[model samples]
Target: MRKELYVYHEGKPVQAVIRTYTERDFDGLIEVQRVSFPPPFPEELWWSKEQLTEHVVRFPEGALCAEVNGVLIGSMTGLIVSDEAVEEAHSWSAITDDGYIRNHDSTGHTLYVVDICVVPEFRKTGIGKWLMQTMYETVVQLKLNRLLGGGRMPGYHLHAGEATPEEYLERVLRGEWNDPVISFLLRCGRVPVGISEQYLEDEQSLNYAVLMEWRNPFNSSSL
Candidate 1:
């Protein structure tokens, strides 16, 4: 809700202060992302604190970060898109598979989760779940309709060109998927809707990825 809020687990008490991302937090966010991801995205792609501030000045509350002891440990980035925009993106073959494109026109709002990362040491301590709960609270407060992202097989290992979609699905269905991060999201609320075959193919890195959706439970009227 605010920077003053603290999430407690065990006796240690994790003081997670969430706020809108600023230029000053970019470097710290980048560091957190690098440590949290296996093949971290390039740091250069993130805008400087100044640029981010400018960007947020126009689109306020677009990005958020969680910090403990003044150090950023996790962050979530998302964008508000229209149903038309979603349809347009789906129209492109290289973007996503048709099975993954749900009918969002009936939905009121669409908040696409671009990224959500937490440092390894702080995970499984209830911090990740707290952060997600906080996100749901924030989304409801902001009147957003849904939360969406991609789920990966946690801790999954790729053996060169030997990987296959069927093997990945089998692993996930069998509950052998190893990626802790993705598993954490799944446990929190994200549901597997479809496979992100294009993303996996373009990256040439992972064997499987799934599109996930987390609808706003507060929307009683829609339900």
Candidate 2:
């Protein structure tokens, strides 16, 4: 699928194309991660050629990237997973097969999003939402039960001294607090199913993650 979007870059609107990434886009994808997640975010967590290759070969439809003038600026990756994987508390590495996504189940009922990133400059340009909308369409087209993703509590570390992760989550749910990642997911129409400990190595989240899910409205089973 291909979509054309007018996104703001440097205060000027530029056309961007969203499409399923190919093997040739690996370098661009890697570059996006490098710029999107920096410092505290581990460099080792960036996408690798092997992982990108596996994504294209195993589930190309779930791997998408946005480009402007042939330069990639954002990407979102997902792998099909069974309900059992969604029900259980699994770390990012486990569900995504340590980034290789070898555990992708073609018969699975859920589309488990692994990662999403937009370069700092291009953020808030509606690129992320457009990417998510594309995946939502994929879920409906494939008749998947829901869209699931683990969200980091990037703002939790700041409130760690005042509240435990659980308490912080409650506050966020109650609208008394806003967590960068969790709040973003909530705004995207996902609800928190639960929390996963050590879901990722994110320092800002204190290694904790919120299980975010957006059920497919057209799927009765999802309801």
Candidate 3:
């Protein structure tokens, strides 16, 4: 196991280890997505096996998985993109481009985290934090300036009929409300940069997302 990426869940050491994905982990990736993310977002929202396989081929290092007892329990998928790309509004499918990931620009200075899923059983075990920290480490390794993503506001579903995203965010920041995705990102030190409408088909986020960023505070170049 990689001590650098160790984690704990539910009063026990998380019997999982994080690593870049390999060809064999594809099925586990699908299973994690299905089991971790609950319904109503439409099955189309999930990554197809072909798409995930191609992504692993294109940017192996950007696709990470947490294996527990040899079963894949978590996944974090990302694509390298230019700073300009992230500045624009993008849907999950648009950024991923039907799983082709056509926008993985080598010259880009940002890593766009397209998806991060952990099985329901593994939720709240610090697994998400470990995955995010690993993402930070990846940015430094790749010499990128930051990590950028359009993250779901899972708590928005309940308030979408009454609250504007702006109002909702205010509540989240005030601690008057709690959003699983937003709160997790907050724990990872990611800052909300903007509001993106129609970001994903997720009912939880009301099809909206928050543009977030985590700048590398310890890039090797700085040292």
Candidate 4:
């Protein structure tokens, strides 16, 4: 599915396209992750050739990229998981098979988002939201139960010493605080379902992630 939208580019708006990822997009995708998650974010955790290859080959529809003027600026990756798997709290690595998506099950009922990122310069221009909406569309098209993901609490470390993760999340839900990740998830139509510890290795989030979900309105089973 090719989706077109306008995004800020060099201080002006430019047309951008969102479409399924391809083999040639690997390098561009890596660059986007590099700038999006800079140093201290574990450079080794960035997208790898083998893992990206697996994404398109295994579940092409789940791997999407956004391009502006021939340059990839953002992307979202996903894998299908069963209801039983979604009910269990799982780490990003475990759920996505260490990013290779080796466990992707076409018959699974849920679309599990593994990662979503946009280049720092291109953010706040609706690119991230568009990528998310595209994934939501995928859930509808596949007639899946829902879209599920573990959202990083990048802003939680600041409140970690004063409040528990749950407490901090409460404040965020009540609009007392705006977590960079949680707030964005809420804006994208996802609701917090629970918390997952050791969800990722990111030091910024202190290995904590909020479990978020967006149920498909068109799916009767989800209703």
CA shift of 149, model 2, Å:
0.9
Where does candidate 1 stray beyond 4 Å? 1-11, 37-41, 45-51, 87-108, 154-167, 170-176, 200-207
Tell me the spans in candidate 3 whose CA falls farther than 4 Å from its real position: 1-6, 38-41, 219-223
Candidate 1: give the clashing pairs: 23-49, 154-178, 154-179, 155-178, 155-179
lDDT of 2 by residue, 26-82 (tens): 988999999998877788888999899999999998999999999999999999999
> RMSD, model 3, all Cα superposed?
2.5
Worst 10 residues of 1 by lDDT: 95-104
The most accurate candidate by lDDT is 4
Task: Kindly report which residue pairs in candidate 2 clash with one another.
Answer: none
Those runs of model 4 whose alpha carbons end farther than 4 Å from true positions after fitting are 9-11
Can you rank all candidates by lDDT, best first?
Answer: 4, 2, 3, 1
Which candidate ranks first by TM-score, i.e. highest?
4
Q: Write down the lDDT of every candidate, Cα atoms only.
A: 0.59, 0.90, 0.80, 0.92
Which of 2 and 4 is ahead in TM-score? Answer: 4
RMSD vs true structure, all candidates: 5.7, 1.5, 2.5, 1.2
Per-residue accuracy of model 4 over 67-116 as CA lDDT, tens digit each = 98899999999999998887777898899999999999999999999989
Per-residue lDDT of model 1, residues 1-223, tens digit only: 2655666646677667877777677789778867875455555544345544543453345467888889888876555556455543232223222212232232437666555677887766666676666667666776776766666553445532454655665565567764454567678887766665445432433545666677777876424
The C-alpha local distance difference test score for the whole of candidate 1 amounts to: 0.59
